[model samples]
Target: MKKVLIVGAHGATAQIVTARLLAETDDQLVLYLRQSRRLAQYADNARVTLVDGDVSDIEKLTAAMAGVDVVYSNIGGVDLGTQTKHLLTAMQQAHQTRLIFMSALGAHHEVPGKFGDWNEQAIHDFLPGFREAAQLLATSKLDYTEVRPAWLTNTDEIDYETTTLADGFKGTEVSRASVADFMIKVIADPSLYRRESIGLDKPGTDGDQPSWL
Candidate 1:
């Protein structure tokens, strides 16, 4: 079984990724979170190991990453780029090669329409950090797939479409579950999208602007 380490284990998207990892595979799970209380639900599971600590702490992160085959990071906010450096360092020390990171749609100015404008405006302060983190992942020696999901929604469906950074982003709002599903797929097969930034959106729902907007 693959030993998987998931940072930001307490967040909404990370929670879905955790659930999928638990239900779909026999892989050993390491959840790194700032608070242990948030992951009490997995206390009964023999396969799930919860490590309480900050992602920015290299020593703590490296210890948690021991023998891990894959790393899935879903961290955000203004310090995203800084935090990513920490993750990269820990993974490098552990000699882990595969990394699947969660980044927003506009990190590269790939999103289109009013929704894109609005999304960028809302996250203007956070983009610098995200972009910095993206640059680090792009230049790293490790195999990394930076996930850029557009204007996330809370829908139950997993239907989504994707395009490369060169092709530009399509549609607008993609469900969080869809992004999680895609991450799980990547975990199962790390060969897909190696050293690439993938943009995801719900198919045909939002053109220039999300229908809801």
Candidate 2:
């Protein structure tokens, strides 16, 4: 069975990915978070292992990565680049190569029109770090897929579209579940987007801005 380690397991998108993994695959899951208490509900699951530690701590992260076949990082924020560095180091130490990272759509400056402008304005403070982190992953030799999700919603629908980095990005918004679906698909098929960066959004929703905004 595949052994999957999910960093930042408490995140909204991660919750959906966790459920999908448990329900669809016969894989072992290690849920890594800063607080074990946050994953109390999963403590009793036979296939779920709860690891409490900071992603920035290589020692703890390396320990948590034992026997992990793949890693999916759902964490975000200003320290994302630092955390990704730590995770990469830990994964290297553990001899693990597969990584499915959750990133934002504008990380590559691929978004277009007024929506792109608005998105850049909104995330101006945080985009640089994400872009740096994306660049790191892009240049690294590890098997990695950087998932750049457009504005996300809590909606349950899984209708989504995708764009390769070369094609540019489309649409403005997509459900979190849709992003999770894409991630899970990539995990199941390791050859899907190796060493590539792609964006996700709901089909036919393209506009000057996300509908909600």
TM-scores, in order shown? Answer: 0.95, 0.97
4-38: candidate 2 lDDT, tens digit per residue: 99999999999999999999999899999988898
Model 1 regions lying over 4 Å from their true place: none
Task: Predict model 1's lDDT versus the native.
Answer: 0.89
CA error at residue 192 for candidate 1, angstroms: 1.2
Candidate 1, residues 83-162, lDDT tens digits: the string is 99899999988888899999988889887677678778878999999899988988899899999987788989999998
Q: What C-alpha lDDT values do all the predictions have?
A: 0.89, 0.90
- Which prediction has the highest TM-score against the true structure? 2
RMSD per model, one decimal: 1.3, 0.9
> What C-alpha lDDT does candidate 2 achieve relative to the native structure?
0.90
Candidate 1 at residue 195, lDDT? 95
Candidate 2 clashing pairs, residues 3+ apart or interchain:
none
